[model samples]
Target chain A: MAAGNRRVDVEEVNGVTVAKFTDKKILDEGNIQLIGNQLFSLVDEDRRMKIVLDFSNVEYLSSAALGKLITMDKKVKSINGKLRFCSIRSDILEVFKITRLDKLFTIKENQEQALDGI
Target chain B: MRTLPSSKVMSSSDDLTEEFEVLIPSDTTAGHEVQERIIGHLQTRNYHERDVFGVRLALEEALVNAIKHGNGMDPAKQVRIYCRVDSIKIRIEIEDQGPGFQIEDVPDPTADENLERPCGRGIMLMRAFMSLIEYNATGNCVILEKGRTIEEAEANDD
Candidate 1:
């Protein structure tokens, strides 16, 4: 996407890059695509090996959004990187559990927990 | 014996069903608009927060599948949506303009081997959130339903 339309707020905590989603819905197809690109850039362009996805601002997300996360996870792994998700709402957490993505990804209750071992 | 007015009778009935139909172009933007309309109706009916959340998510997936997969994002094509939000249940049917698909052919996204795949989770999420989901024989149209317990609906049931 464009530099003006940043989809994530990226910060660094102890060498671990934290990318927090800025959108609340994460439903728009264009938005999801941009998010996917932005996330991929973290692994491919920025060469950030350790990452955490903060979902505190996300109130809703669709399967397309989930698809982006799956791809993001794969990209991180391809680089021998670590990615964790933190502060997912109960509803979205149910989605992860239902899709069994909870088992595939490292999910923690809060940013503190997610950053602890990473 | 006197009977209530037709509208009054409807209000007194066990279910207050509201029907909606809209034809949207083969674009996901249209999908978001329709989703908001349906979600707004459910919110007005005072559906439980979780029920609203699930419906919103399922509706999003179904619309994306119709516009992106079924319609192939062809602007010349259109998607037809028929919905009924009753007192206790919501039924939505979405029809697309592309060749039909076979639901049976869709691999299980949650399968052990497919866990890493990114694309095939829409159908799985729909089934997870909604009470029922079925595709027509042609697979161009899919039906989604959810049975929710809204407080006002429960009072009406009694």
Candidate 2:
């Protein structure tokens, strides 16, 4: 059941935790909440883990889902950990740009770029 | 998504008039139903891809505001949605039954001080994607329109 309800596929690469989302559209509130919890869990379990959120599969995202990412960023910052977003589609990237969150969080063009420094 | 949109009453017409009205309770299901219906109609018409994406985002935000913030998620209250979709243009209006607040009171989420704030970005996103977003005096109702022009769409592709 744990893997069944999980909206993200958590994988470790080069000592970094990469949570690749499985859903194409992250707009639904239920999936957003579950995704938030899973993202939070990565840090909650180990505060020092560097996290990379791969969004190549996400086609649609809502402001509510963005709200969750903001919260997760804060949580990671509180622990002095690194959290990055990568592989964002142009449209979803525009959402971050419009919200001015591109400045607030670390964003990269792809997972390779995200993991390069973090 | 917890709120999968409401599917109260969709007008069954043989014509391609993408106009329908839905009356939904505060349960948060009806709003999504309307969103799906409108987006599906837009896709079938071969609307611009960017327009379709933007419309879906703005519609999601507006519906959330109407159901969660406007109606306070009160099951007793009802939200009404009116939608009209045409080729390259769409108009949607959502009104909640709860007492409305002033639109001026919402803080600028993009401002320096409030940038980290998680809430209050719905209206901002709605305004950014939609060509026109006008709220009535009560702020309980919001009207959103997006008319994508050929030149503009080409410009966006650049």
Candidate 3:
């Protein structure tokens, strides 16, 4: 597998690293690990301190994926970086709300909104 | 209606009923294949994307709980999944061969003190997405159900 056969696509937009996941479904183990590794690599190699995850194409994610997100969020913060999400569907948004993570992260209505105040 | 032995797959397909069952080891990696199989079946049935995501997420959480929490990631243990689908509803039961926990004792992840915790969100996600979420008396088996509402069907048709 190529090194870039990653689950996330990182793009630098206006000084923010926008990582968009190509896969619609983020369940199962392999994809979750791929995502985790991608983000870890981003932080370690590219020195991306601010990230905006575009979840517009993603409809849902497993709890393990959820855990990975939490871990990633903490990882970014540990390095004094910022992490936010955009274009989250309602179904996945409900999970965030139920877990009260909505209060923890900055979720915007769309990518444009996520870019605001950054 | 009752539990069966390990490694038994009982499937039945008829005019009005569709059912599937599988027994898998505690390897979390296998969960992807199972989710794919089930979600593919649901898509063939013309379930909405939101509903598909909902079912997939719920089932993933259940399987993760069964593998990690219930079976303690023991490869020797197994997770049994039974799914029954009809025109009106879907019911999936995931059971693990491990010592069960008291469902009531689980701390609320949404609580003030627990808000930052990474675990305990699986159960909350299951309850949020599934129309009906129940556990067997032993708390090792979880039954998640979702009914297609008339409004949703109409919306899909529109």
Q: Compare candidates 1 and 2 on lDDT and give the better one.
A: 1
Model 3 lDDT, full chain set: 0.82
Docking class of 1: high
Interface RMSD for every prediction, one decimal? 0.9, 0.9, 1.6
TM-score of chain A of each: 0.96, 0.95, 0.92
Tens digits of per-residue lDDT for model 3, A1-47 = 36666788778899998989888878767778888888787787777
Worst lDDT run of 10 residues, candidate 2 chain B, spans: B1-10
lDDT, candidate 3, at A11: 89
Which runs in model 1 stand beyond 4 Å of their true positions?
Answer: A1-3, B1-16, B150-158
How far in Å is the alpha carbon of B46 misplaced in model 1?
A: 0.2
The fraction of correct interface contacts reproduced by each prediction comes to 0.87, 0.77, 0.74
Q: Give the clashing residue pairs of candidate 3, or none.
A: none
Residue B155: error of model 2 in Å? 13
lDDT of 2 by residue, B22-132 (tens): 788876567777788888988898778888898999989988888888888988888889888767678899999878878788888989899988777888888989999
Per-residue lDDT of candidate 1, residues A15-101 (tens digit): 999999998999998888888899999999999999999999999988788888988998899989999999999999999999999
lDDT tens digits by residue: candidate 1, B1-158: 77645431123233466776788999887788888888887888888888899899988888888888888999999999888886678899999988989998998888999988876688888888889999999999999999985466566856
Worst 10 residues of 2 chain A by lDDT: A40-49
For model 2, state the Cα shift of residue A42 in Å: 0.7
* Candidate 1 residue pairs in backbone clash: none
